[model samples]
Target: MIVLGIESSCDETGVAVVETGAQPVPVLRAHALHSQVEMHQAYGGVVPELASRDHIRRVLPLAGQVLADSGCALADVDVVAYTRGPGLAGALLVGAGVACALGAALAKPVLGVHHLEGHLLSPFLSQDPPEFPFVALLVSGGHTQLMQVDGVGRYTLLGETIDDAAGEAFDKSAKLLGLGYPGGPALSRLAEQGDPAAFKLPRPLLHSGDLDFSFAGLKTAVLTQVHKLGAELQARKADLAASTEAAIVEVLVKKSLAALDRSGLQRLVVAGGVGANRRLRAQLDAACAKRGVRVHYPELALCTDNGAMIALAAAMRLQAGVQQPSDSYAFDVKPRWPLDLTAIA
Candidate 1:
């Protein structure tokens, strides 16, 4: 089966094609992505209107590119899949609309996939894919969660952020340091030059004894530190950036370990944009290695929002018999769909 996936969740427009064979796992044939980072950079964040308009302009060309790269024709696609929720509504609509229109035009079935599930199952597309019954740390844009996964569509929410998520903490803290848009990467780049021990930033709920996370207080702590730095902030900015990244990384690592211990799972899969963080990956590798646990992550390129994960997820769900594609052309999107809502045994 060939699955064509479209993703316009926020600042990126992505399209890809994947094929399933006798094996349960599907393989990515070709994928293409266009980042709106440079466009959003001017505004220090995404502007919903501009993002939607850009999606309108980019999705189809990218889809054509993926088809050409994969040596497949639009008529040859078996299923059309698109991210259907938990993103900017306008952005989601552009992808959903185009996907449904294609399905209607091709007379093929269409599937609406949960955006988070795309992130959750993305590692399956990697060279070293994870097996079932593992723990997943999904640290996407505004979401930070730990889930117990038994298989496709089977998930138990172990814990999640109560306030600001880890990504938010990174972005917000970087803003405090006068970093440009896409704060996480900027802060991490500067962090390479300084010491994490130069300043002490709070790690919220590191000892809460529960799996839930809280980073709002940590963001506040960063603000306080920035205010105190005053005129000296420029000279010591790198140190502060390093310290801030350290605090967020520590919280994420500790909580992840706690979730693994609580779930008694030996395998960990980290997904989402924050999962791309070098500090988080390095620390988790060391910590999990010490515990004799196996840790998995999507290829660095797939760590961000992309069409490959979306298409791979749809293929897996179809293979598992958990999701049924529709012949009806009518389509809608859920801007706030929860992952657990699709959880099934």
Candidate 2:
């Protein structure tokens, strides 16, 4: 089966083609993406109007590029898969409209994929993939959660951030330190030269003995540290950055381990943008290795929002006999949606 996936859930406009049902697994024919990070940088955050307009401008062109790169015509696509919700309504509409229109034009099936589910299944797109019934730690800019995945589409939320997500904390702290928007990556790069022990930041709720997390207080701690050090801290940005990264990584690794222990799942999969953090991956790898458990991660480039994951997810859904919505089917975007609502099998 050939599935053409469209992802416009956020600032990224992505398109891909995947051929499924092969012996080893599905094969991704071609994948293309256009990121609006540069455009949104000036605003220090995503401006919904601009995001919507960009998606409108980019989706069709990206889709064309994917088809051309894959050496397939539009009619060759058997299914049109797209992110249906959990993002900006206007931004999502662009993809949804294009997907539905394409499906109608080609007389192909149209499937609405959940964005988070796309993230959860991302690891399978890599050379090494984890089996089912694993523990998933989803750490993104807007969400931080731990889930138990018994199989595709079968998820049970174990715990999540009660306050700001870990990525949000990174960006917020970086902004305070004079870093620009999307500060997570920039701050992480600076932390490499930082002395992890230079500053001691609070690990809020680290010992709460519960699965839930809280990073709001940790950000506040960074604020207080900045206020105290004033010009001195600004002069030593690298050290401060390193310390903050270390503290956040420690808390995340500890909590994820706790979740694994509680769930009794030997396999762990890290998803979402924060899963790309070098420190987090190292700590989790070490922790899982010591415990004789396995850890899985998406290809680093796939960690952020993209279309390949969505296509892979939709292909699996089709193979599982999940029905496609009717031509009259129409649903609006959801700024917030729980993953457990949809069952894969």
Candidate 3:
């Protein structure tokens, strides 16, 4: 089966095609993505109205590109899938509308997928895909969560951020350092030249016993440090960045390990934009290796929001017999849907 997926959740417009049934995991045939980072850079963040408009202009062209790249025609798609929730309402609407319209025109079924589920299942598209019954750390700009994933659509929320997520801490902290838009990457790059122990930063909830996360206090701590440094901020920027990244990575690593120990799961999967962080990956790899635990990750290119994960998720859902696409063109999107609330088999 061929599934055409569309993703317009936030700042990126993505489209892709995936072929399933021949392998245990769906194969990504082709995918296209257009990032609005440059466009949003001027604003220091995403503008909901601008993002919705850009999605309108880019989604179809991206779809065409992926279809061409995959050597597939419109008629060959067995299902049309799109991210349906936990994002900007306008952005979600654009993809949902286009997906339903295409499904109606082509007379094919359409499926609405949870955005976080797309991230959670993304590692299945990796070259070294992980088996089911693993722990997943989903650290994205809008969310940070730990889940026990038994299989497609079967997820138990282990813990999540109560305030700002890890990504938010990174971005907001970078902003405190006068870094421009897309601050996380900028801060990370600068962190490479400094010492992780250069400054003290809090690791919230690291010893609370439970698995929940909190980064809001850490952001405040960064602000305090910025003010303390005052005129010396410029000279210590890289050190501060390194220290900030260290604090966040420490909490994430410890919590992830706690989740694994609690669940007795030997496999771990890390997904979402923050999962692309080099420090997080390196630490997780080293820690998991010591315990002889297998860790899985999507290719770096797939770590961000993309159509490939969306399409692969839809295919896996169908293969697992937990969901069925609808023939009816009428559709609605849930901007705050919970991943654990999705269909489970």
Backbone collision count in every prediction?
0, 0, 1
Residue pairs with colliding backbones in model 3 are 86-335
lDDT of each: 0.93, 0.88, 0.95
Sort by lDDT, best first.
3, 1, 2
Least accurate 10 contiguous residues by lDDT in model 2 = 322-331
Q: In candidate 1, how many clashes are counted?
A: 0
Off by over 4 Å in 2: 323-325
* Candidate 1 Cα outliers beyond 4 Å, as residue runs: none
Evaluated at residue 61, the lDDT of candidate 1 is 95
Candidate 3 Cα deviation (angstroms), residue 155? 0.2
* lDDT digits (tens) for residues 1-345 of candidate 2: 889999999899989999986544578899999999999999998999999999999989899999999999998989999898788888888888888888888888788888989999989888898789899999998889999998877789998999999999999999988899889999999999889899989998899989898999989988888899887986788988989999889988998999889998889999999999999999999988999989999999899999998898898777766646446536466667788887842
List, residue by residue over 25-139, the lDDT tens digit for candidate 3: 8899999999999999999999999999999999999999999999999999999999998799999999999999999999999999999999999998888999989999999
Q: lDDT of model 1 at residue 175?
A: 92
Candidate 2 pairs with clashing backbones: none
Residue 235, candidate 1: Cα error in Å is 1.0
